[model samples]
Target: MKNIRNFCIIAHIDHGKSTLADRLLDYTGSVTDREKQDQLLDSMDLERERGITIKSHAIQMDFEYKGEKFILNLIDTPGHVDFSYEVSRSIAACEGALLIVDAAQSIQAQTISNLYLALENDLEIIPVLNKVDLPSANPEEVTDDIVELLGCAPEDVIHASGKTGFGVDNILAAVIERIPAPVGNVDEPLQALVFDSVYNPFRGVETYFRVINGEIKKGQKIKFVATDKSYFADEVGTLKLNQVIKQSVKAGDVGYLITGIKDAREVKVGDTITDSANPTINPIDGFEDVKPMVFAGIYPVDTDEFEELRSSMEKLQLNDASLVFAPESSAALGFGFRCGFLGMLHMEIIQERLEREFNMTVITTVPNVSYYAFTRKDPDTPVIVNNPTDLPDPSSIDRVEEPYIKATIITKSDFVGNVMSLCIEKRGQITNQTYLTPERVELSFDMPLAEIVFDFYDRLKTVSKGYASFDYTPIGMRTSKLVRVDILLNAQPVDALSALIHADNAVHIGKKMCEKLKELIPRQQFDIPIQAAIGAKIISRETTKALRKDVTAKCYGGDISRKRKLLEKQKKGKKRMRQVGNVEVPQEAFMAVLKLND
Candidate 1:
């Protein structure tokens, strides 16, 4: 245990965390020069393409320095704010963290958020300044920022360039000298925390765990403390580049345990694994279920493919326990599932993966955040609603509460005015603002999470010219005068097109939605009226004129009376068609109004 070092990397996105990991892997010979690619720990194709770590991955490295052998357990965590829960679990699993900050871009939004998390976890933090080789790098300024933020001496900060090999070896030496080794009671009954897991078709579920007490071996009967499900361990081993089977995984070690249980549902993150016969007296703390914050509906483009979509979702969920979904049907869209995700990015990644990996075509509705609705009769028992359709009638509701977030945005001084205006437009209240440096400023706001969950992030990136970074934490709930708006096609309500919006902008949004639907929906034989309404009152309307048959064509060169008679007959026919004809709305027509203000 004295030779074992457990530490993970935390950084802002695009801050060279993955690059540093790769450099360390190559330096230790854990990954051969020929075997490594950029962002080696980020194995998913989406992750590689986006250049971000979406999932947390762990590996064991054997390093020799000064004639001493050290086992370094490196856990690479996601840098995006949306995956903070995942980051928290990774931090909890380790005894120390390698906090990497880009020298050119010192202490962005996620940098502060993750630093606080590492401090809260009581992990020894090794501050490293990356990207020192860049022409714009300011190592000294960033070192000062770290010293001020972490209260560590300027000399204690390690400087390294991820792209180049400079200071790479020195950082490893620092980890050995600074980070503490894992300490646990080996004689205590087995108590391991399941931090992560992946599903295998042949082996059932492959679980990654950190042993806190005792040891686990092949053939031992194990039980998950949360589910109380027991399975005999078929194999237990450490991850060396890949799965390397071993007879036993001792306490203070990070390893994988294969139970030969084909069902992935039995194994979950935050669950405790203990010996069945000699169970531990208490389960380790800090295990939290990943509750999804964003909700969206996913339906098959072809109704016949509903079953196929279900199978794809089930298979996908086996690997991603954070994803939540249940069967739901829509009048406009057939049978489908309403899915919950950690955030909008997570929702998009899951949908993309389902299409790319499973070869499934799905139609995803606009994402929404959960809201609380209180009925006048049951004001104390506020109802939780994930969809606008589930909300109670406006008359029966006493008050509606929406989720709020405390957001921290780091941007250049030039764009502070623009960022402030954007936040105000999203109904944000400025709580505080601080100048991090002469050129960079951190703007803080208390805003509705519903507002930020939509196009706020994209708009921030656009208005700031990609120089801004953002991180937010939920700040409970606040009352809001929000109402649900419904879109109607020829007086027939389209339930799938309903959206919840603030009462102040309902008229403006209704007008734009009605007009946009006019452009998207094809004209029918009979005139169709596109309308937006709050309850029974129409707020906005647009007309799609019916096609004219040119009934007077046959009357050419004939008398004027003949032309008049033909026109009158055509008018009567059109009137009769309008009385009975139904609008045939295509799929794109429904998706056209997804983002009204985009």
Candidate 2:
């Protein structure tokens, strides 16, 4: 146990975390010459293409220092704020973290947030400055920033270039010297923390865990404490370039377990795995359930495939434990599942994964935040309204409360005014402001969660010219004057296109929704009236003109009265068609509501 070092890498997005990880693996001789590649720990194709780490990857490395062999378990984590939950889980399973900061960009919002997370867990922090090879890199300035942020000595900061593998040996030495090893009793009952899991079509679910006490052996009966389900361990192994099968994995080791449990729901991440016969007294602590910030509906393109979509979601949930969902039905979109996501990026990644991995094409409705609605009769009991259609009648409602978030933004001083105006336009109130440096500023704001759900992040990037980094944490709900805006096609309300908005911007948003839908919805044989309404009052309207067929073309050179009669007949036919014909709301129209500001 003294020679074992378990740690993870945490950083802001595009801060050279993965690149530094690759150099570490190469120096430790964990991979062969053929296996060498950039971003080696990022195994998913989507991750490589987007240059982001969507999942946390764990791998074992072996090294020898001064005639003594050492075992290193490195877990690479995502840098995006949406996957902070993943970082938390990874931190729980490790004793230390490598806090990587980009020398050129200095410290950003996500860096500060992730650093706080590590500090809360009491993990040993080793500050490393990466990307020193770039011409724009400012190692001296960033080193000073790290010293101020971490309160460490000047020489304590390590200068490294992931591209050139500089200072890789020093990082390894620091891990062995600074980070503590796992401390547990091998004689104690089995107590393992399951940090992650994945599904396999051929075998079953594979769970990756860290053994805190006792040991797990192949063919032994193991049980998940959360689910209280037991199964025989078909295989036990350590995570590497390829899974290394082992007869047994003892305490203070990181490994994988296959129980042949075909059902994905059986294995829960953050659950305790124990020996069925001699179980541990209690489960691990500090693993809190994920709080979803955005709610949206996901439905199959074909209604009959609802069951298939359900199964796909179950398998996906096994891989991504942060995703929460329940069955729901919509009048216009039929049966679907209301999914809770961390944020818009998290929601978009899940949708993309559903299409790429499962071969399931789906339609996602307008994303919204969960709201609390109270009625006059039941003023004390608040109804959770995740969808706009779930809101109670306007007459019976007492008041509605919406979730708020404490947003932290770090940007250059030049864009401070632009960023502040953008936040104020989103109904945000400035809470605090501080200068991290003469040219860099950190701004804090209290904003409604619903306000930033659509385009706030994108606009922030735009206004800051990609120099700003943003992070947010949910605050308690506050009462707000909100109203539900319903989109109607030919005077019939479409539940799928409806959204709850603040009363002040209801008319403006309603007008935008109407005009956007007019351009998206195709022209039919009869005119389709697109209306945005708040209850009986229509706030805005747009008309998609009908496709006309010239019935008078066949009667060319005929009497003017004859042409007029033919035109009147066509108008009457259009009116009759408008009454009986149903408007087919294209999929694009449902998504168009999100791009109202465009």
Candidate 3:
């Protein structure tokens, strides 16, 4: 335990944290001679395809320094600001963090935010400037920035190119020399904090954590602090310290425990596992129960796969603690589940995983923000509405408030003015600004969470030419003029196409939404009018350009069977759609405009 070192790799998105993680595994001989992979920590297909780390991953490796064995617990956290909650949880499981900065780009908005989180937790931070092989690499400037921002000594910075394995040994050496050893009592009663967990088909639930202050072995009885439930430890599998071998783990060492637990709901993140005989104190703080902010209804294109979707979600919920769901009944969409997520990215990742991993195609409804309303005679009433049809009557409410966030954007100084104007146009108020470097600036604003949920970040990058970065934290909620916009296929309203938009932008946004829907829904058998309506008023309308050929001219006598088959197929397909007068609206037609700008 005296030689144990636990730390997380912190960096901005695309700053090469996963690349560096792969390099460290190689440096420590954790990678076998027969197997070599790129970005090994990004195990999910969606993560590799999207080029972003969505979840926190941990692995154990052993490093030899001066002929002495040192155990290194490498924890890789998501770099995006939306997943900061996951980052916080990962950071809590470690004793220190390696602050990885891009030498060519210097510090970013996420760099400051993650560094501040580490500082607040009093975790030891070792600054390292990566991508030193780039022609534009400026290690000296990046080192200075680190010193000025983190108050660390400039001489402590390590220059490395994770892609080429240059200066990586220096990173390992610094890890042993600079990072403090884990400190805790090993001989006391068993106590372990479950920082993370994964479900295995064979082994059941595997709960991983640091043994803070006691010795735990197979066959010992333990208890969880939060649930107060006790269970017998089936086995204490040999723990991995990166590539090193460990027969037994003591206090302050990282390890995993396998038990009779099969349900993920039983073992939770941030829960303390302690010996039944004698337990230690629960050092859980700075951790809050994760509540989902954005919600959407996920159903299948084929109703036959409904059971498959349910099972897949159950399996996914094992690894993702932020996902929440409850049975949903829709008059138009039929039975489905109301799924909750941390943010839009989190929601998308789950949907993609369902298709890629589980092989089930799904149709998702428009995402909506949870709202709270108060009347002149009543107090605030909490309501969760994803469909516009569920919106409360405007006259029955005295005030309505939407969640707001305090955001910080870092970008090149050349586009600062444009970013500021974009923020203002999105209902944002400037609070502060800072010159990060001669060519870089940080702008802070208070904006509605709904305003930035969809494509705000993408637009920010588009306007700034991919040089802009952002970070946001919830501030609270404020009253706003919110209106519900419904879409009618011909005249009857389609509940799935409803949205809550600010009153001021309704008309212009309604027009853009209708235009987008016209492009998404394929040209129907008959021309379909896509209209955006508020009550009896139609503000915008567009049509799917008329169908070229509805019926084949060669289906008459001998091909009567084939023609009957084709007509039967079309009838079954039309059963999945909603009809309003003469128009047949495809399911995608209703789901298309939800992500119009996305």
lDDT of each residue in 153-228, candidate 1, tens digit only: 9988898988887888888888888988888988899999988888777777788999999999999999999889
In candidate 1, the residue pairs with backbone N, CA or C atoms under 3 Å apart (3 or more residues apart, or in different chains) clash, namely 204-262
Output the TM-score of candidate 3. Answer: 0.89
Candidate with maximal lDDT: 2
Error of 1 at 147 (Å): 0.7
Candidate 3 has its poorest 10 consecutive residues by lDDT at 238-247
Q: Give model 2 RMSD, 1 decimal.
A: 1.0
How are the candidates ranked when ordered by lDDT, highest leading? 2, 1, 3
Candidate 1: deviation at residue 343, Å?
Answer: 2.0
| Candidate 3 residue 485 C-alpha distance from true site, Å | 0.4
Q: Model 3, 1-598: lDDT tens per residue?
A: 7788999999998898999999999989988966668878877787888889988888888789999998898889989876777788777778899999999988988988998888888888888899999999988888888899878778788888889999899899998888888778877777677777777878788777778787777778888878788888776743443323344557877777888687656877788888877776654453677777677888777777777788778777767777888777665666778898877778778888888878988778878777666766675565545556676776676777888989999999999989999999899999999897888898999999888867788789898998998887788878898888887765667676788889999988889888877777666655577898876789999887655444545676675778778777766555444352255446566556545666
Off by over 4 Å in 2: none
The candidate, 2 or 3, that scores higher on TM-score is 2
Work out how many backbone clashes candidate 1 has: 1
TM-score of 2: 0.99
Error of 1 at 367 (Å): 1.4
